[model samples]
Target: MIVAACVKLVDLRPGVDRLTGAVTPSTTLGCSAADRAAVELALQLADSWSAESVVVCCGPDRADPVLREFAAAGVDRLVRIDATGAPDSADVAGLLATTLAGLGADVVVCGDHSLDRGSGSVPAFVAGALGAAQALGLVEVGTEGPGTLRATRRLDGGRRERLVVDAPSVVSVEGSVAELRRASLAATLRAGDVPVEVVAAPGLVVPPTVTTRPWVPPTRVQPPPQGTAALERVVELTGAMVERTPPRTVELPPDRAAALIVEQLRAWGYLEAVPSEPATDG
Candidate 1:
């Protein structure tokens, strides 16, 4: 089995101030901790099934570090996608799908979400584009043969659900397997000696949707949430829970809270007032 892992390059640290007419301050997007963990798990599972190779797919601008890490962590190949520094999710997804197709991979893997967008939609979109089944938010994946893959997905309310799907499918791992392994001195020295050939796809165009906006905001660090702040948080939480009820607190002076509650309930389609019946139809 040929298993491929897809990762996005993400900004390690965003800038405090933005420069005029430059690439967006944010750059270098990649797998989150959860994503990394999932990749590791997927690799182990593939290894169990005697996978032919494990490939790490990433963009040219920001893929070096991840590729180096994958090389050190025992990946057979690093598939490079010629992505610009600020390509959006759609572009990345499309590029990834194309790259996997070219690689003749049997299974594709990805982090559940990118650090930048956090939408977690690209993997499914890529799967759909490739005409493959998707098993997302997976914690465990095992394969019986080249054609059959079984995965344990994380479901709502902390439950695990098992799914069986055919290969050439996309699976997004939900968490990091381990800290991205730091490069050893030997690995770093050897990486320079190793040849990395980037397969560049010509004339791949990704169009923008919304207009780009300029202006930047200042950064401020808030105080820790403890002491008086903790008490205030408890009070705020209690107040919010209280607000959810149609019946108001008894402590408030007669009818104000009740009236507000009634107004809210009516607006929310929960209550309607009925007129009293006229006496003797007068």
Candidate 2:
């Protein structure tokens, strides 16, 4: 089995000056959190299945160091697509799809969302371009059988769902699901010498289907209160300063505690009805 993991280098340090609201580049550059999660998942799956793993990235020449970090993390191959200027998310997906097709990858992994844009559209777009089955927000991945893979997805309110998809599928992983392993000194040194195959961006044979709207900040209006309203405001402020109550704790058996938690969650409208089990005739 062959897995291709896509990653993006980002500036994680403080980028915005709080007082001036001016943006600046970070002192250090590293893989985006979501991308690191995807890479870690790919590496884990590759190790468990003894499969070949490749790390793919696209950016300016400055991103070479970030790609090397993936090599140090134990990917069999590192590929860098040399792309300059800011491309739309669709174009980036197109480039990645084309590269993965050339690599003949059986599985493609990517972050659920980018740190910079947070658009959360590239993975789906790449799957569409490759005509591959897609599983988004995956927390865990494992091989089910030959040419088949299982993905465990995280849902809101701590729910999880499992899905199985055929080979040549695309999966986008959530950052909080996994932690990346640290690279050893020897691996880091070896990575410095590894060749990074750079390629030109693929031609935009197909135009992007999505268009972004102009951003407009919301406007807020504040009307001053007058007369007795000021006196009422002071009274209301004083009333709001009530003492807080600490939460009560309860002890119960594990099973009973779980049941009670589930019950309360359902009562609070945080959980839907339990799915009915399939009926079987004896």
Candidate 3:
């Protein structure tokens, strides 16, 4: 089986200054130790299924840097899509589907969520585009036959579900399921000369509903301290649980705040009062 791993290269430490919300570019934006561990586990899983070739794909902007990193991490070919596009979920999904269509790939795998866009749409969308079955949050991938694949998916609340599907399937792997592997010095040298195929964006059309913006919010000063301990105690007691606290105190308007408080209370089963009956229209 030929397995392809889709990897997203993103700035590791994103966000303007926590204080000023300024934008800065740094090399630390690549994959982390945990991500490397996950990739390693994924490679091992693919090997277990007798995958003859494993290709890692990334966007043009991230190609060189990611290729170097993956090369050092023991990955042979880093498939770099040289087209300059928005890298939107749907657009990238289409690009990947087109690339995988002729590769005779039996199974495709991608990270459950990318750091840049945690939309969780790419894998499934790619599967749909390729007319393949897809499994999300997969922890383990196994094989059933020459053209069949089995995936073990991680579910919420600490459970797992196993699904077996025919060839040409997509599997999105959870970061916690497998550790991405780190490349050795020898592997890096060998991977440097590995042939890379540059593919165009295929003029795909992505939906216009999504917008990319740098998240910048003006810094706000903390509220003035009141000397009265009793007042602080009252406010604390009246406040909801700490875990449910929302950041950006001013972001929630009055109506939204009321709705959220009531919703949280209902979710926690703390609301004991019953509403009055509505009057019939005359």
Off by over 4 Å in 3: 14-22, 32-38, 145-147, 156-159, 202-282
TM-scores for every candidate against the unseen true structure? 0.65, 0.69, 0.66
Q: Model 1: residues >4 Å from true position, as ranges? A: 18-30, 56-58, 145-147, 176-188, 206-282
Task: State the local distance difference test value for candidate 2.
Answer: 0.81
Model 1 TM-score on a 0 to 1 scale? 0.65
The per-model lDDT (C-alpha) reads: 0.68, 0.81, 0.66
Question: Which one is best on lDDT?
Answer: 2
Greater TM-score among 1 and 3 belongs to 3
Off by over 4 Å in 2: 14-22, 156-158, 202-282
> What TM-score does candidate 3 get on C-alpha atoms?
0.66
Residue-by-residue lDDT tens digits, candidate 2, 198-272: 878856444433534445576668454333787776655565645755566779999999999898789777799
Candidates 1 and 3 compared by lDDT, better number = 1
> How many Å off is the CA of 101 in candidate 3?
1.1
Worst 10 residues of 3 by lDDT: 29-38
What local lDDT score does residue 19 receive in model 2, on the 0 to 100 scale?
Answer: 49
Q: Please, what are the lDDT tens digits per residue for candidate 1 over residues 1-282?
A: 677777766666665434543443455445587667655655665677677545555466456765666666656676676655456666667777887777777777778887867888888988987888888987776676765778888888999999998887888877643444455778766765454447775666645534344776766795553436777777665565445536545565668878877877887877976576778954
